[model samples]
Target: MRTVGNDLVRHQLHENRKWYLLLGALLIIFGVVLLASLGMATLSVVFLFGILMMVGGVLHIVAAFKIFDGGYRWLWAIFGVLYLIAGYYAFTAPVQTAVVLTSLLAIALIIGGIIRIINAFMFKPLPGWGWTLFSGLLTLLTGILIIASPTSPFWVLGMFLGIDILFQGINYLTLAAAIRNIPPSSADV
Candidate 1:
């Protein structure tokens, strides 16, 4: 028995099921292609990041002029300039950019894992605290391995991106299948 909200969601999903299917197929193909050409994919990711940083810089500069006032305006402008410089560096030296980004990712993961472990201990009285600690330990180990691995900076980001896209495509495919299974009510016709 479906609630009204569930029925409505089903109806909407059913209506857009084809789009989901198409997106899923496209993403899956792209993910496979990325995984096949890891080096190219890595460079592509770096280029995309550069483009995003440049776009952000432009937006920040625009905001400084159009939205911010007084000291905020200067701060925004300064940030915009910094973003632009970083973007330029990313574009000019993608390999270096990847190394820097990978290092940052490892550091962030380590910090996040430590925080989670601490939180798990703090919440020891709560159920599932053990799972939290386990997850934190796993994350910490992964970060350590990434930092220690020689190949990490070259392909880790691309590999992660490919896997993420693959999972997302699977998710969409599953959603589409579920939507297709939904029964059409009289109102749908």
Candidate 2:
């Protein structure tokens, strides 16, 4: 059994986790809102989000540099480089990102629907399968529509932003909530 001191340390560790989770939650919210607003407007939201990502990516690179003395410095540098590349892409092609986001959403929905249908079939339930099946079918139909007209710039951008923003908001909220629930660390003492 751990001593009381260890318990306190554990609790402190939990608190740190809570803080990181809160940060992640914020990121998710930002992504969703940025995407949604992009849908509502046009290039403004996309630019804003891209700029944000770029700034964050640059900061990450600098941090990685600081850890050069560590064993995994190369790995960190690689990650930093990858983020930089992504940031550059986001900055250069916000519009394309908007369209891509829409495509991704449709594909995700279709996959999710298929998975749900499969799950429903897996469980031998004689009742309450109607709703599941209906939802799955609807998702599949939406997916088909997305695939049928990937070139519709307006629809794709609008939906992409809106859906991205909403989902990101929800993601942030969830992460924040999870962080808030972690037990306090003993280190507080």
Clashes of each: 0, 9
Looking at candidate 2, the ten consecutive residues that score lowest on lDDT are 36-45
lDDT of 2: 0.66
Error of 2 at 133 (Å): 2.0
Which candidate wins on TM-score? 1
Per-prediction TM-score: 0.91, 0.53
Q: Looking at candidate 2, what is the lDDT of residue 101?
A: 61
- The global C-alpha lDDT for each of the candidates, from Candidate 1 onward, is 0.88, 0.66
Across 1-189, the per-residue lDDT of candidate 1 in tens digits comes to: 467777677678878999999999998998998898888888887888899999999999999999999999999999999999889999999999999988888998899899989999999999999999998998888889889998888888888888889888988999899877779654586
Deviation of model 1 at 8, angstroms: 5.7
- Tell how far residue 130 is off in model 1, in angstroms: 1.6
- lDDT (Cα, tens digit) per residue for candidate 2, span 70-121: 7566677677677777667766887687666666777888898897787667
